[model samples]
Target chain A: MRLLSHNLLQCNVKNCKSNNFPLKIQVDKSNIINCEFRKEPLVKLIPKLDWNALAITVHNLAKNKEFPEKFSPALLDDQKFMQELHRILMETHIIEGALICEGCNKRYPIKNGIPNMILNDEEV
Target chain B: MATRPENICPPEIYYNQDEAVKYTNSTRIIEIQEQLTERCIELLNIPEGEDQLILDIGCGSGLSGAQLSEHNHHWVGIDISRDMLNVAVERESEGDLYEIDMGQGFNFRHGVFDSAISVSALQWLCVASKKSYNPVARLKKFFQSLYNSLRAGGKAVLQFYPDGAQQLEMITTAAMKCGFGGGVVVDYPNSAKAKKLYLVIQAGGDTREQNIV
Candidate 1:
């Protein structure tokens, strides 16, 4: 799943929907797959992304936390920063991992590049 | 022919491995899905410009999501079947896929989607899949959450195969309760085989989204 989508996803557990901001990543089982990148889509994507969620995911996913803590409209013009932003947003993939919710500690497994967000009966 | 039966197994089991392959690989389903997806998008009347995000409900094998990508729009597909999603993955679908049930509702932040579409999936929620399932309650939850997920004035165009008029009424009533405007739009009404029912819903906030049906 793209961290782009992960940046918007929240833990849908019964009461955890509000604060499930950045679902914690268990990166030991993760893998990165190379993908094609175009600068325009990434440029258009900046405003839609949750800066804090993406930054936190990078830190926990073992990617050395390359993101800046704050979001600036000017970052769109920064060629050097945009290239690194492209690397994290476009190139990396979470092939295998479990995303644990900060609010409910619920774990959603990611297998074969797809994140399984289905919840059981009691959990909902 | 794939109507929702009261005692039918859940989507995961019904669309399991071999069935998923059968559904995705069928030439007829692919043709039908393509036509239905395009029809739904045409009804969306998307304001053109940059790449917008669309949500595909029950996006089996990414056929519908591919249509969204053709317009350079991004999409996120949610389905209840893993095997179906596996095929979507193999297709190198531009959109991401998630295994989530529509009955319980989605997990998107407020005002995230530009618009939404569901093809041939809404009928599944009309029947009780489990003993604990309540049709009215499930429909309410789905509508309420879907109402919140869209940007104000965002539209969700859902194409469903209703068993009867009663089923359509139930779904529409629930949506109305959650503050949705717009109503059912029937395409090709004279031809039984080609007839399709679409619910064109707009999230109510400030502006009322008028239905073009």
Candidate 2:
């Protein structure tokens, strides 16, 4: 799973509504695949993102990296910054990890880069 | 007539390791899947020069994900079968894979996807895989979550094989109840073997938009 997907997913465990988003990334193994950066796609996707969530994940998993706590429209115009954002969001893959939901503390395991989001029948 | 695999077991069990490999290795199945995927993309009618973030529901073995990649679009795929997702991982599919049951509802943030597509998958939701499963409730959850996941004008093209008129009605009605607009498109309606059913849905878009049947 990539950070791009992680930014979108929230815990769907039944009746656990608050703080379900931005699952904490517990990375045991990670991989970086070099992909060509496209500014247009990222430009369009920027508005849809939860900036705080993205920043938090980057800070937690990607140590020493600091992105602005707030999203600035000006940042979209910077080619180098957009490239960096693309690499962090799209290229970095979580090979083995577990996403811990803040609300219910449900651990969704990631194996071989695929996240298992299946919930138990009782939970659903 | 051969019995439906859905009647035998749920997707996760039915598409076991052996079945997953056999399904991917079949030339006929691959060809059909590719053609249907291409058709779904065409029906999506995404504006030219835009790279979309697509969601592929029930993306078995990355067959449709490969097609999405060929179009240079980024995609996230969700499927119920672990064995099928393993095949997708082995294939090194460009799209991210998630082991999720569609009937359980999507977990994505609101308006995260530009468009969505499914091929040969929706019918599985209409069948009760377990004693406690309620098809109506499940279908409502699936459609409601799907409606929430797409952009306001985003579209989804789902190609499925309905068991009969009743199954088709159940699926369409659920989508409509969730505020989706548009309707079914039947291709090659005159031919029994070539007939294909596509549920072309748009999220809160212009209700007057007509589908090419």
Highest-scoring model, TM-score: 2
TM-score (0 to 1) for chain B of model 1: 0.92
TM-score of chain B of each: 0.92, 0.95
Q: List the residue pairs that clash in candidate 1.
A: none
Residues A55-106 of candidate 2 have per-residue lDDT tens digits of 9888888773667788888888777888889998889999998999999999
lDDT of 1 by residue, B1-213 (tens): 664543378777788889888888899998999999999998998766657778898887798999998888889899888998998888888787888888988888887887899999999888887889898988998898788888888899999988888999999999999999999999999998899999999997435334433
Q: What is every candidate's alpha-carbon RMSD to the true fold?
A: 2.8, 2.7
In candidate 2, stretches whose alpha carbon ends up further than 4 angstroms from where it belongs are B206-213
The true-versus-predicted C-alpha distance at residue A28 of model 2, in Å, is: 1.2
Q: List per-prediction Cα lDDT, in the order shown.
A: 0.83, 0.91
lDDT of 2 by residue, B22-100 (tens): 9999999999999999999999997677789999999989999999999999899999999999999899898999999
Clashing pairs in 2: none
